[model samples]
Structure formats: structure tokens, C-alpha cells
Target chain A: MTDTLTCANLSKSYGGVVAVRDVGFTIAPGEAYGLLGPNGAGKTTTISMLVGLLKPDTGTVVVGGADLSADPMAAKAKIGYVPQEIALYPDLTGRENLRFFCRLFGLPRKAVRARVEEVLDLVGLADRADAKLDTYSGGMKRRINIGAALLHRPELLILDEPTVGVDPQSRKSILDGLERLVADGMALLYTSHYMEEVERVCDRIAIVDHGSIVAEGTRHELVALVGGADRIELTLDGDVDTALAKLRGLGGVTEAVRTAAGSVRLIAEGGRYLLPSVISTVDGIAAVTAVEVVEPDLEATFLHLTGNTLRD
Target chain B: MRPHPVLALVAANLRRHSRDRVGLFFIVVMPFVSIIFVGMALGGGAAAARLPVGVVAQESDPVAAAVLAELRAHPDLEIKTVGGEEELRAGVRGGALAAGVVIPPGSTRFELVMTQSSGSGMAARSAVDASVGRVAGVIEATRAATSAGASPAHAAELVRRAQAASADVEVVGSDTASATPRGFAYTAPANLLLFTFINSMAVAAALVESRRIGMLPRAFTAPVRRGAVLFGEALSRFLVAAAQAVLIMVVSSLLFGVSWGEPFGVAAVVGVFALVATGAAILMGSLVRSSAQPSAIGPPLGIVLGMLGGCLWPAEAAGPTLDTIGHLFPHAWGMDALLTLSRPGTGLGDVLLEVAVLGLMAAVLLSLSLVLFSRRTRTL
Candidate 1:
């Protein structure tokens, strides 16, 4: 059996506010899954429950096929968590910090020494492992934070906002590290609000919103759910509904949304094949000034499903 | 068993603690140095005190000069000359002379008169009394032996028999008196107090730092139980605190020559006090977030507790009110136990109440801290 993590009907609410409601998903072994969402979505809440950092108000969390809440130690043994906040001890040297976590996972002394060296190399902190974290730059601290979790080499790794608030170079390095972890046959449940990150790294993506998974599947599969491979956006001079109505009448136009500023955006299946048709079809509207045909992006898929920008 | 995750944390914490030179200095060195400094400040030996005194001689007898010379030889007494009885009385009242010695005219006797309630006055008058009493007895024995028809050598022998008495002091208290600690004996108890307090601050900082760094959160995510974390933390703190207590006992006795009374009893008291401080650090760490909060809060609290519990000074000097108030601090109970243990000649049984109370307090505080700490980790 694949060592996968599953959350079954996990629901949590604070008073009258539901944070994660009836959320269910599973990450296959060695499969890198992204829990993508906008701000205020249930991504973090679900990650919190899945990692056993929180007990869901209703339902159960299972890691590596073992119930998390049922036998936490057993469930936790198979999982490593890299929290959103940088969690490395600032007072300790990188080597010392890794050794500290290695013991926490019960690795033998010899194994601990080996693992510390390995993790330091993995995180690109091998040369700087002797330096105290307070002396490290923000990027170095983030890498050390990730290294602490990687020391034990658990079956599953959970990273909450894995690349939050880092320089672009560090963020790329972190993503590269995550990809390598997956290649090393480690399953990952990565949560982030960054659309490009999810698209670039995850094999499967689940869009979470308002405490539920509104849409989820592989990137191509999910974009295919919208039934159109391309989305065309038209900026209308003053009146957008007139142009949107004309665009909707054209063949290959699957859906059309008119934004508040008179920009009409059309999500169409087989967008590339229908781009010329869309341009010629909307040419009669005369209100259309600019047209752009975009490929199936997480942003468009997200907007198609949630009616809001991925950032929003 | 997967080598208890908390034990690993304990080792790391201890390592970090040792790395903190400033904290280690405060924990291990400050108490040791404070003992030496405070001992020097208090007078390291049972040397006599110099008291300001007034002497009123109504008669210009040459015997009075002889008495003054005898008084000068006693290391503890410093006698001063006064103009008249009125001047002596005024000097004593105005706080210049601790007491006044009046030698009445047409009489062979002398009188000691001053506020007996003052420590300085008591010390002064006691010194004067011993010297005068020695001189008077010898003279009286001489007259009596001569009257009884003894030879000059025989009279001197009688005087020797009469005058050979050990020096003694009669002390009394008043408002403006400088309080003497039941003297030289406050060292052992005070050292116990100071060591416990400094170690507690260091432990508190360690605990808070662990929480802030997310080490505690990471530990909880592993196969480690929260109880293990709490116990591990306590163990680390106790290790440091126990070492601190041993240093205090050794230093106090070696340098101050402070008799720590029953050796085993002193060890037991120190051990229990360390536990109490460990629990307090855990509690403070759980109740706050970040190292700054604990570092900021621990030392000040330790200092306040030290003062209230009579670590820097004796709780005895604080009297009934402050003494009762001092019991609110765990250090007070520990100090009281130490004081009983070091009271020149006190057995373990003599401090049972204090020991039991301190033990109970340590148990309760440790339980509360464990409960709080476990709650914090249980979330993750």
C-alpha cells in the first residue's frame, strides 16, 4: 500500500465561522500535492489539522494510513512538519540545531551525525553549519528551518507556506529542495497561496475556498474541467456586457465574465483553436479595443471557479 | 523506546545554556562571587564592634584612668570622653554616644545609663560593663584580702581569682539601630537563596527560548509525549540548579567558614530548592512567549523573591511582618530550612516543617508548570 495521507470529512469551525468544512483529500506516495487557495481560504486550517497541529472540530486526520488523532505518535512518526514560521533555534549553530532535531526523532548518535551532515548539505548550509542562526540571513534561516524537518526523512512531509516571505532566489532554492525531496520518494502536502508555485511544483492541485475544496485535480485535468484550454480577455472601451454577449455567442467560448471595469474575459475550451474565431467574432462589437488570449493558468482556472483573482 | 525526544531537547537546551556565557556567569559565578562580596561587606570574622560612647567622671580619681586603659585593650570596645553628666546624657540622646558611663563622686561604684533598646548601645554598654566589672572586682578583692591580713603576693593572688571572667555583652534595641544579622551565621542560608534564584533565571530563559524557536513545537510533532518534554526540561533545569546548590554550599563553607550544619540536611534543602526554582521557570516560560519576556521577567522576579526571602540578607532582620511576607516566596521556605540546618547545632528534624513545606511547594509548582507546559505542547 502506498504511504499516503488522507483527511476524511474534516470540518472545523470557530463559533459560527467555519474554517475548514467537509474537506477530504489524499496525497499519494511520492506525489507532490499542492493545497492552493486565496487569502482567507481554508488551506492553512486544513494543513494544521492534517499535520496534527490542531484537532478538527469534526472528522479525523490520517497520515500514512494511520489515524492521526487515534495514535498520534504512530501517525506522527511517518510525518515531518515545516511550519509557516521559521522554527530553527537562533542560538544554536546549524549543525547543532540539526543534531537537536535528529535526537528528537530518536536517530542513533552515529546516524544523527550522518543525518545532520546530509541535511546541511541538502539545504545548502553545509559550509555555514557552524554559524549561529542569528548570524544567518533570512534565507539561510528559512533553509535551516526546512532542514530541521528533513533530518529524519519521514514518509510524508508537510510544508505550510513553504516559500513565504523569502527573496526570489531563496524561494527558488526552497522549491528546488522540495522537488528533490519528492524525487527521493517522499510524499509532500504543500500549502501556499502562490499560484505559480503550485503550478510549477505540484503534481496534483486542490483549490480550497470558504472551508471547502471547490475544485481539485492534476493541473491539466483541472484546467480541462473548465472545458477550455485557453482564456481570452478583452478590455472594452466603456460597455463590456455588449462585447461579452457577442463573445459568448461565438463558438468555442465556454464561459464569459465581465469585470467591474468593462473588461470582458472569456474562458473557452480549445482556446488556441478558437482564438481567431474569438478575435473575428468580437470584432463586430467595436467596443473591444484590446484582446489577449491566455493559456489555461491556475489564475484563470481559479477565477473560473471562484469568481475572484488568485491573489484576491 | 525512541530515545525520548525531550531528552534530546534537554541535552540541546543544556548545551545552549552553557553556551550563554552571560547566563552561565549569572547562574554559577554570581552567587559564588556574591557570597564572597557580601561576606567581606559584613565583616568576615567575629571581631568586636567599635561603638561611640560617652564617659562622665564626677571624680578625677586616677583609678578611672586605669579603668579606661583596661577598656582600651578589649578589641570590641571604643570608649569616648564626655564633659559632664548633662553632656553625656545629651550625647546619648542625640545619637552620638551609644551609651554613657557615669562614675559618681564620693563613691567607688559606676553606673551605665543609656537607651538600652539600641543594638549599638547594648554592644557599647556590654563592653564597658565587662571592663569595669573586671577592674572593680580585682580592686575589691585586693581590699578584702588586705583587710583579711594577707601579704601583698597573697592579695594579688586573690585579685587574680576574682577578676578572671570571660567578656560578655548586654544589648538592647531601639528605632535607629543598625540591625546585626544573627551574625556570621546568615552565610549558608543566604548562599542557598542566591544560588537558587540565579539558576532559576537561567532556566527560565532556556525554556522561553525553546518555545520561541519552535523547538518545542517540533518536538511535539514527533513521537515524543508532552510529559516527556516537561520532565526533560525539569531534568535539565534541575541538573544546572543542583550544580549551583552544591557550589553554593561548598563556597559558603570553604570561604566564609560558614558551618552548613548537617551536611546531608543541607544537601537535601538545596536539592529541593532547585526543584522549586525549576518549576517556577517552567511556569513563567509557559505563561509568556519569546526569550525576551522570560529574560526580562525572570531576573527581576528572582531578585524580588531573593530579597523577600532573605537571600541577600536574613529574613530575621525583616522582623515579624516582612518575615511573614517572605514566606510567600519559595526561597523563604528554602532559606528557613537552610537556617535551621545551619543554626550552629541543629538536626534534620529541627527543620521538618520548613522542609515539608518547601517540598510540598516544589511539588505543587512543578505540577502546575508541567500541566501548563504540556497544554502548550499538546496543541501541536
Candidate 2:
């Protein structure tokens, strides 16, 4: 599938300060791609450039096979961007705001009412269609903001921290709406520091930092690159020293962690070999309750690659 | 990816503006109230209503009392005590008294002073001349009878006959049909000048808001040319100004019976005036980053310009230096053109120079705004 949006060597600077530097990435059609980065890691800057809101000092952006600067109208037609801030007029009603954007896009009169109702319903805001935006709750406003971008039925949706500053219910609704859009064959470029959200939605991700992509892969592919290790967590009653010694001495084991109590754990490249060894290492342990080895999640893989939590 | 539907957006913006309470209050209530107040203040017809003229006679002589009392008896003329000539002039200036009559220390003839404080000083001059003329006519009649040796009954008959005839005020060899000019004839046109300017300048908010909301960016993202957005915004403001000018004209002409100089000539002058206001507002608004600054600064700035332009008062009342300085503002030229058109028997030929100059001013302002807005956008 062709990439709906592409940026090569994208770089931006504000006077002496560098905001985005040498970043390159592409969002393929019908695929949900995440741009995961820390708060000040240039996520917003990249989105701004890709959307043609900010001019990049050095880079090329092509949206829907059209060069943004060279052929802007074609690019804008395919993209729907939900801004990071509440941008609609506060005094205007939700329906009124939607109609304005619809008109701005030059939508047909027959399609306008239907599209407005459709998007509002999709965002779970059909009931609040007539309410003033200023009177809406944070969640309701967020839904309406997203709904506005959906007015023109863009093929590619660019959501910039869509869940930021939103309540859990609203965030879920937004996430669900995004997923529904993608399922309907719309391509999405979703950016956020929330790794779980990225992992839940995106088929592929580019972990960005300092205006560049540090890692790019599927969730499992990234973990393998970091030398996949099983996270073996256990609870025990006694013999903490012996357990730590035995697990550490094992050939395949990478590290043996002992709790302040007698509980002990092991992390290794191979989970099968270390499981029995760990069980035997902790002798005389009371009520050895649980033993489970799971694949490294995107959170662990992200932390392993970036050496920082996604929340940061 | 798309072309911006500028006209539709502008229409939506206009719709929202119509409902805005703040905008409504300024566009509607301000003019309505000021017209009533200012119209009665400068008036014969029912606007700025008329200033109350007070008369005080230090002379308790029967002749002097009759003159003062005769003025008090005139219809629609409100009379109060006239303290002194200076005080009466001061009252007129302060808008308390339209005019005042002070009888000289011994002579029966009173000193008359009219205030040039209002849009037209006709109300003040007439109010004063009528009051003082009555007393003077009575004294003159008494003197004539005494010198001719007429009897008391004959003198009474002569004075009575003289009192029966009222003297009329002739301004520039023409008698005003009414005591003062009619409604927007007195106010609406001035307000038209004021509102067009204020509305155009305040439109800076729409520009600022677009920037803040990222609408500018999205608009640029469209294959839409940068010129389109610039043109769209300027066009929107100009359209608003035109609408305001038309609204004021219609209301003034239809409701207030205000006769604009010549219909076609007035329309041409107002059109250019609207253009000037539109360009000025866009240039100023683009210079500022925040929408709040434009709305805040544009009105007061427009008011100051309007004051100079003759919206608040006639520039003829200003000193020569002040008049020259006031012409630096487009409102001054616009108002001048309007005045020429409004005066009796005047037509397109009379206001031709004003129209040409104002049209040139609008062209310059529009070009300047285009240059400024483009330069700022490029730098951004």
C-alpha cells in the first residue's frame, strides 16, 4: 500500500533553538501509525510540518502522492487534522461549527447535513449538536473537535495527541472512534506519549526523539532487536540469598533479581531453560504462588530502546 | 489538498457577528442612543433633541422684561435664566445651554452669544437670535413712539403691532425649514462614517483568530495561494464596511428623513470611504499578533480619527492648523465629501474633488495593507 503521508529529512528550527531535526517517516494507507515521543521530543513540530501548518527549513513532505508545497490542495484534500487545542468559536453551537468547516471545504449542500450528523454521531456527540461549544465539558468538546475534522470525509486522519488532557471516558471514545475510522479504510497518523495507546492502535510505530526516529518496527520486531528477555516475576517466603545465587549461576540467565523478602525472579533470552532453574533455586520457599513468562510488551520494548518510560 | 471556500466562510463569520451581543450593542445601541442625544442637542427635528436656551434679564424695566418673556413664549423653545454672556457661551459649549442672552448693564438690548459646539451651530444661533431679538424690537418700538410724541394708547397699539411680527433668522441668506437639520441628516451619516471605520478595524480579530486557531495553516495547506487568504480577509472586511454603510444610509434616509446630498454621488463617496476603512483595519490587525489588541485599539483609534474626520463635529470649527492636520485622516476627506453632497442644491459636481481624493486615499491604503500583510506572512 502507498503511504498517505511522507516526510524525508524534515527539519525545523526557531531562531537558535532546534525543534525538529532530520526526521523521516511515512504513514501508509489503511494503517494506523504511531509517532511516539516524550513531551518536548518534537512530536508537535513534526505534525505541524506534515500538515503544512509550519514550513520546514529543510525537508520534503508529500501527502497522498502530492508534494505539499508544490501541490497543496491535493494534499489538504486527503488529510484531516484535529489540532492540539480547542480551536472552534466558543459562542457557536457544535452543529454551527461543523457547518462552517463543511462550507469551508466546499461540501455539497445535500451532503452537508448528512455528513455533520454522521460525524457527530460517530464521535458520540449527536445529542450535543445544538449545545454551545463553550458550555461543553472537556470530553464533549474533544469529541466535537474531532468531529469537525471529519466533516469533509478526509481519507487520511492526523490526530495530534487526541487524548491529551482528556478524561478516560472521552479518551476511550476518541480511541474507539479512531479505530472505527481506520476500520472503514481510512489511514491514520496518531501521535502520543501513551505507548499503550500506540500499541493498541498502530500496526507500526516510529519512536521519535530530538526530531528523529530512533526506532521503527512492529511491537514484537522492536523487542527482538533489544535481545528479547523474559520477565520472570515470582513470590517466595525465604532463602533469598540462595535463590539469587542459584539463578545468577545459570548459563542462559541474564540477570537474577531477589526481592527484599525471599521472592526471586529471573530475566533471560530463553524462558524455558530459566523457569525450572528458577523454581529449584528458591528452596524452602513458602507458597510459591505464581510462575508465568510472557512476551515483552511494547512498553518494555519502548523503554528498552529509549531508556525512558513512554509517559515521560 | 483543497481550495478554501472563502465566501462561504465569510458568510458564516458575518452570521456569527450579527448574533454577538457585544457587536450588536456597539453596532445598534451606540448609534441609536448617540443619535437621539446628539441629534436633540443640535436640533429642530427629533434628534440630539435641542439644547435648552436660558435667558436672564438684569434689567427689571418693563421693555426688557417683555423681550425676555417673548422669547420664553416661543414654541419648542426651552428657556432658562441667562447668567452672563460668557456663562451662556460656556453653557452652549458644555451642551447645557444652546445659547444665552445677557442684557447690557444699562441698555435694553441684550448681548447674544451662540455656541459652535454641535454638528451644525444653527440651533444655537437661532435659539439666541430669537430670544435677544424680541427684547431689542420692543425697546426700539418704545423709543420710536416716545420721540414721535404719540399718546399711551397709540404707543401701545404701535408696540403691539410691532410685537405681532416675528423676526426670522437668515443663515447664509437662506432660512432653514426647521430649527435644526433632521435625524441622520444630523447623525446617521456621521455614524455611517464612524461605524464603517470601527467595523473594518475590529475585523482584525477574525484574522488573529484564524492564526491562533491554526486555520491560517490549514488554509495554506490547501493548494490555495497565499494571495487568496489575504484577498479573502480583506474582502470580508470591505464587505462588512459596505454593508454597514448601506445600513446607515437606508436607516438615515428612510426612517430619519435625512437627505444625503445626491444619491449616486453619496453612494460613490461612501463606497470609497468603506474601502479606506477596510484597508486600514486589515493593515493594523495584521501588524498585531493578538485579536484582542485589534478590537481594543481599532475603535478608539477610529474614534480619534473620526473626531478629526468630522464624525463627532465639523472640522470647520477646528483651527486652521487642526483642520490641516485632521485631513491627514481618510475620515476627514470622506466626511467632507459627504457634507458637500448633503448641502442644499449641491450635486456630483460639488463633491467631485472630495470623491477623487478619497478614492485615491482608499487605493493607497488598500495597496499598503496588501504589502504589509504579505511581508508579515513571508517573514512568518
Candidate 3:
């Protein structure tokens, strides 16, 4: 089967600044792909170019066998995009907003009513579909926003940070709904800075930074990049910078950096055995208040590759 | 089987407008209310009362005195004496007097001076002319009697007896037809043009709001082309302007007894002017950076343009320079077309030039606005 989306060498720049540089990816049908990056890491710019909102300085995109530059309408028709912002109309009820998108997408008039109903049920907003969007919670509005994208039943769905600013319960509902969509044979390209979400929903994940994809693989394959290294997080009581410096010089500690939360995180081989020496190395500079020797994961993989935590 | 995206957009805009009570009040209710108030302020739609007329007699000529007395005796005329002809002319020109009559020295005929552009001035002229014409007839009959060798005293007695006999016999005549409609009829069309344009321009805020909320970008993500989106926005504005025009026309006609002349002529004017308004609205939406900017500026700008275009008063009455300047706005052409239709025996053929000019204005404005709006939408 043909890939649902195939983009290669995507790059964009604004004036003198480069936003995305030589980025490329492809997603098979029914597969979930995640582009993980922190804020201002060029995820949105890449998405914008992919959706044809902006012309890439140099690149190409193909959706369901249609070249985006040659046949935008056909390419766009095969893709569904849910932007990070809640883009639904506030004055309109949920049903009205969905019906409007259906008309815009040129769905058959006879099928619009049934399709709108189905999408509302899929998003789990059928009971409150008649309520205007202004009356909905942030999470509910985000669900409606997602529902709008699904009305046309595009072959691939692209969501940019879908769970940002949403309540936990509603976020869970959105994730559950998305999981069902992926299971039912819809390709997904999800972008977010949240590590757990990407790990939970994406079949394969790509760690993006500085407008380029630095690493790409499945969960186990990505963790293997860390090479049997364990992640050790240390909470220091005093002089975190000095402790970070000393920890970086330790024999077993390959990587050590101060986190945004005033803690030192280090990656080392056999971190469980190195814990005693790790505490002794920082003993004079700062007292070790807490320590956790975590096994290799995507976060450790991101840190291992980018030399910076995903939260950075 | 699906509706075109342009029509879908138009439908959605109209639905949003319908839900906004404040917007409905401005677009639907305010025009008629303004018509009633402005019509009443201009002394229209009320019972006819006594009109003030100034009289100037250069000499104490008995014939002139008799004419003045006859004018005063007429129930519809309230006569005021002026010291000289200049003062009488000034009074009529200044609108203190509806009309003025000057009886020159050693002349039997009287001069009637009034501003022809004023409806009341024209009415006063008719009343004064009737009184003067009656006196002139008596004078002519007396002179003929003298020419036949009758004594002056006998001629005077004969004229007095003739006047006494005619005093008890009253002849009522229907009022003369005018090209312009008075009272609510005049205000209805004027306010219709004013409010429709203003309301259309104000709806630019909606476009800006859509952009701010990311709705425009979301729409662009659909399978539709940029041209379809721009056309959809323009079509929605046109529909709104057309709806406002129709509502004002229907309500004014039914409630206030306003007779809009020649159906096809009125439609041509309203339809073209609606397009012009849509163009202006689209241009404003494209140029403004924020929703508040259009809301703050649109109404005041519309009012100024309306005033210049004769929505507040007759442009002709404002003199030649202003009348020439008024045509620069589409509202003036619309007003000219509507007023032409109000005249008896006039049809679409008679106001073709005005309609053509308005159509041209609409074309230029729509073309320019569509180009700007297309460029702006791409950035959004």
C-alpha cells in the first residue's frame, strides 16, 4: 500500500532566520507518527508547510499519491488538520460548526446530516452538541476542534499539540478517541513537547530540534540509542551548578546537566552501581537530597541525542 | 448536490448576524427610526399649516396694497411686510420666509422670489401667485371698463360688487405634482442609503474577528481555493447590504405610506448601491489591523460620506459646488436615481445615466477591494 503522507527535504525561513531545515518523514497507513519538539522548535512551521499554509523554501509533500504543489485541492482533501488553537466559531453550536465545515468540504448534501451526527458521536459531544462553543470548557472546545477536522474522513490526520491547556479528564477523552481512530486505520502525525503523550500514542517518534529531525525510531529502537545507559536524576540542596560540574567529570557519568527544576540529571552506564560514587562526587560541593536511577526511555534518548532535556 | 462554498459562507454569515441582537438593531430597526425622526425634523408627513411669506412694496401703489391684502386673507399664507426688496430676497434666501413678493413702483405685475430647491418654498410661491393673479384680474377688468368710457367711481363700484359676489363661492383645486416626495417618503430612501452602507461597513469587524480567532486559517486548510474564500466573504457582505435595503424599503412603504417609484428603477439603484457598500466593507476589513478599528471608524466615516452624498439634505439645495462634489460618492447617484423615479411619468430609462454611474462605481470598488482582500487573506 502507498504511504498516506510522504514529505521530503522540507525547509522554511523567515527573512534572515531559518525556521525548518532539510526535514523529511513518511507515515504508513494506520501508523501513528509523532514529531516531538519543545516550544519554538519549528514544529508549527513544518506543519504549516506540510498543510500548504506556507510555501516551503525547498521541499515537496505528497498526500495519498497527490503532489501538494501540483494538485493542492486533491492533496488537502486527503488530509485533516487540527491546529493547536481552538479554531471553531464561538457563537455557533457544536452541530452547526461541524455542519458548516461539511458544507465547506463539499460533502454531498444528503450525507451531511448523518456525517455531522457521526462525528459528534465520535468526539463524545453528542449530548451537548446543541450548546454554543462559548459555553464549553477549554478541553471540550478542543474536542470540537478535532471533530471539525474529522468530518471529511481524510486518509491522514495531523494534530499539533492537541492536549495543550486541556483539563486531564478531557485530555484523556481526546487521547482515547485518537487511539480508537488510529486503531481503525487512520494515519496520524501528532506533534507535541509532552514526552508521555508521544510515547503513549505514537508508533514511531521523531525527536526534532533546531528545525531538523535529530533522531527517529520506534520506542525500543530509540531507547537502544542510549546504549545501556541509565538516567540518574539528583536533587541537590546547595550549589547545583558546582554539583553539575563535578558530576559531569565523573568516570561513569557520560552526560550531566542541570534541569529547569534546580535538579541535576545524569546519564551513565550502570547508574545503580555508580550511585555511591555519584553522591561522593557532589558531597563537598552540594548535598544529594534525592536520587532516582531510571531505565532508558525516550526522554533519556532525547537527552542522549540532543544533549538537552525535552522540556528545554 | 452540495451548495457552493460561496453560498455556504454567505449563509453562515447571515446566521451569525441573525443571532446578534445588537447588530440586528442597527441594521434593521435603526433605519426606520431614523427615517421617522428625520422626516419629522424636516417638517414632512404632517398636516399643511400656514406658510410665512414676505411682501415688499417699493411704492404705496393701491394695486400692490390690494395684492398684499388678498395674500393675508388667504388661510394658507401668513404675510410679513419688508422694508425693501433686498430684505425680502434675503428673508426668502435665508429660509426665514418660504417665499417673497416684490411689487415694483409704477408696475402692475408682481415678482415672486423663492428658492426652487425647497419644497416649502415652491408651495409658498404657488400660494402667493394665486393671490397676486386674482388682484391682477380685478385691475385689468377695471382698466377695461375705464377704456370703454365708464367713470372711475363706477368702475371701482363694479369691481367691489364682483369681489363680494365671488367671496362666498369657493373653488378648490388639487395640489400640483412635484418631482420629489415629501415627509416620510423622502426620508425613507435617504436613510435607507445611509444605514445600509453604514451597517455594511460596520460588519468588517466580523472579518477581523474571524482572523483573530484563527477561523480564516482553518478554512484555508480545507480543499477550497483562495478565490473561493474571498468571493465567499464578498458575497456575504453583499447579501447583508441587500437585505437591509429590502427591509427598509418594505417597512417604510407599508408603515409610512411611502411610494417608491418604478419598481425596476428602485431595484437597479438599490442593487448597485448595495454592491458598492459591500466593496467598501471588504476594503475596510482588509485594511484594518484589529476588529476594534473598524467598529470605531466605520460608522463615523459612513455618516460623513452620507452627508456629502445628500442623505441628510438635498444636494442641489447645497448649491453647485457641493452638488458637483456630492456625485463623487455613490450615495448621490443612488439618491438621484430614486428621486428621478419619484417623478410622475419617469421610468428606468430616465435614470439610466445615474444607474450607469453607480454601476461603474460599484465595479471599481469591488475590483479593488477583492484584490486587497485576496492579498490580506493569504497573509492571514
DockQ of each: 0.42, 0.21, 0.45
Ranking by lDDT: 3, 1, 2
The backbone clash count of each candidate, in order, is 6, 27, 0
Q: Once all C-alphas are superposed, what RMSD does model 1 give against the true structure?
A: 7.3
Poorest 10 consecutive residues by lDDT, candidate 1 chain B: B174-183
Kindly list the per-residue Cα lDDT of model 2 for residues B110-183, writing each as its tens digit: 66656555544545556557666756766678778978998877887888876564434334585544443433
User: How does each model score on lDDT?
Assistant: 0.76, 0.74, 0.85
Model 2 chain A worst lDDT window (10 residues):
A303-312
Interface RMSD of 1: 2.4
Reproduced native contacts, each prediction:
0.64, 0.43, 0.67
Q: Model 3: DockQ against the native?
A: 0.45
lDDT of each residue in A238-264, candidate 3, tens digit only = 888878888888998888988756688
What residue pairs are clashing in model 3? none
Ranking by TM-score: 3, 1, 2
TM-score against truth, every candidate: 0.78, 0.73, 0.80
Stretches off by above 4 angstroms in model 1 are A14-17, A229-235, A238-258, A261-264, A268-293, A306-312, B46-188
Over the stretch A1-312, how does candidate 2's per-residue lDDT look in tens digits?
A: 778878899998988799888998787778898888776788888887887767899999998898987877788877888877776777688999888778777687778889898988888888888988889999888888888888888878888777878899888888888898888888899887688899899988888777678889887787777678877777765655766776688777887777447566677887866677667655564446677676677777766666644444
Question: How do the residues A216-262 of candidate 1 rate in per-residue lDDT, one tens digit apiece?
Answer: 89898888776646777777774456667878788767688886586
Question: What tens-digit string does per-residue lDDT give for candidate 3 at B1-380?
Answer: 97677777878888888887888999978897899977764435523456788888844778777888889998867889899888988988777777888888778867888886665676677677788888888988899888888899999888888889989887787566443445676778889899989999888888877777778778888899878988898888999999999999899888887778889988998999999999999889878989888778989988888877778876656677887888899888888888778766778998899989999999999999888876675532
